[model samples]
Target: MEDISIISMLLTAVFVLGCLYLVIIPFFKDETFLDHTRKSHTNGATKEALLTTLNEIEFEYKMEKLSESDYRQLKKQYESQVAKLMRDEETSTEKAIDRDLLAEVEREIEASIQQKSKKGGGK
Candidate 1:
C-alpha cells in the first residue's frame, strides 16, 4: 500500500510538472496558441498586412466563407485604406524633402554671406 501511494504521488508530481511546462514553455519562448490562430493588430496593421487581409478575403470568398457582397465591400474598403495610406506617406516624404532643401539653401546662403564679409573685411 505504501508503494502504491508513492507511485501515485510520483505520478501526480509528474502530471503537475507537465502541465506547468505546457503553460510556461510558450511564455518563455514568446509564443501562444493564439499566435497561430489570430492576427496581431497591436501595432496597427501595415501595408503588407492589408495586402494579406485582402488576399484572405479573396480566399474566403472563393471558399464561400464570405458572400459576394461582403467580399466586394471589404475589398473596396481595404483598397481605399491602402490608397490613403500611400498618399499620406508620399505627402510626408515630400514635406521632408522640402524641409531638407530649405535647410541646404539656408546653409549655402550663410556660407556665401560669411565669404563676402571675410573678403570685404580683408580688403
Candidate 2:
C-alpha cells in the first residue's frame, strides 16, 4: 500500500508538470504568431493619395535594425500587399472605364434621336 501511494504521487507530479508546460508554451508562442499574421493581412490600401509603407520598412532594414530573415520576410509581405493594392486599383479603373463607355454610348444614341427628330420636323 505504501509503494502504491508513492507511485500515485509521482504520477500526479508528472501530470501537473505536463499541464503547466502545455499552458505556458502556448501563451509565449501566440505573441510571435499573432504579430506575423497581423502583418500579413495588410493588403488593403486606399486610393487618391497613394500611400506606400514599404520605404519605412526598407529604412529599418538598411539600418540593421531588422535581421536578414525578418527583412526578407517583411519585404515579401509588403510586396504581396502592394500587389493586392494594385489589383484593386486596376479593378477600380476598369470599372470607371466601363462606366465612361456606357455614358458615351448613351450620349451618342440621344444625339442620333435628336437629329432624326429635327429632320422630320423640318420636312
Candidate 3:
C-alpha cells in the first residue's frame, strides 16, 4: 500500500479510538497515541509552552471560568501530559541502552572475525 493510505488508515483508527475513549472511559484515564506525541517534549522545545498553557488553565480555574470539577479534570489532563512526556523520555533512554548493547555485541563479533582472519582461517 501507499504510504499515504497507511497513514490515513492509521489516523482513522486513532479517531475511532479517541471517540471511544472520550465516551466510555472515566476520568483520570490514559491518553491515545496521537495524544502522546502532541504531548511529547522530544523536540527539545522549551517547556515554556506547557507552562504557559498551565498558567492559562490555572487562570481559568482561579477566575471561576471553570467549575471545580472541570478545573480538576483539566488539571488531570495537563498532569497526564507531563507524565506522558516523562514516560517518553524513559522510553528513549531504554532504546538508547538497547542500541548500545547491540553495538557491543556487533563489535565483539567483528573482533572475532578479525581474529580468525589474522590466524589465517580466512578464505
For all candidates in order, the CA lDDT equals: 0.86, 0.78, 0.80
lDDT (Cα, 0-100) at 92 in candidate 1: 69
**What digit string (tens of lDDT, one per residue) describes model 3 on residues 1-123?**
699999999999999999999988765667686576765554345355556677898999899898989888887887777677767779988999999999999999999989988888645
In terms of TM-score, the best-performing candidate is 1
TM-score of each: 0.54, 0.50, 0.42
lDDT of candidate 3? 0.80
lDDT of 1 at 12: 100
Q: On a 0 to 100 scale, what is the lDDT of residue 69 in model 3?
A: 92
Off by over 4 Å in 2: 1-52
TM-score of 1: 0.54
Let me know the TM-score candidate 2 reaches against the reference structure: 0.50
Sort by TM-score, best first: what order?
Answer: 1, 2, 3
- In candidate 2 the C-alpha lDDT for residue 9 amounts to 100
CA error at residue 68 for candidate 1, angstroms: 3.2
- 53-92 per-residue lDDT for model 2 (tens digits): 5676678889989898987888798777667778876897
**Which 10 residues in a row give candidate 1 its minimum summed lDDT?**
36-45
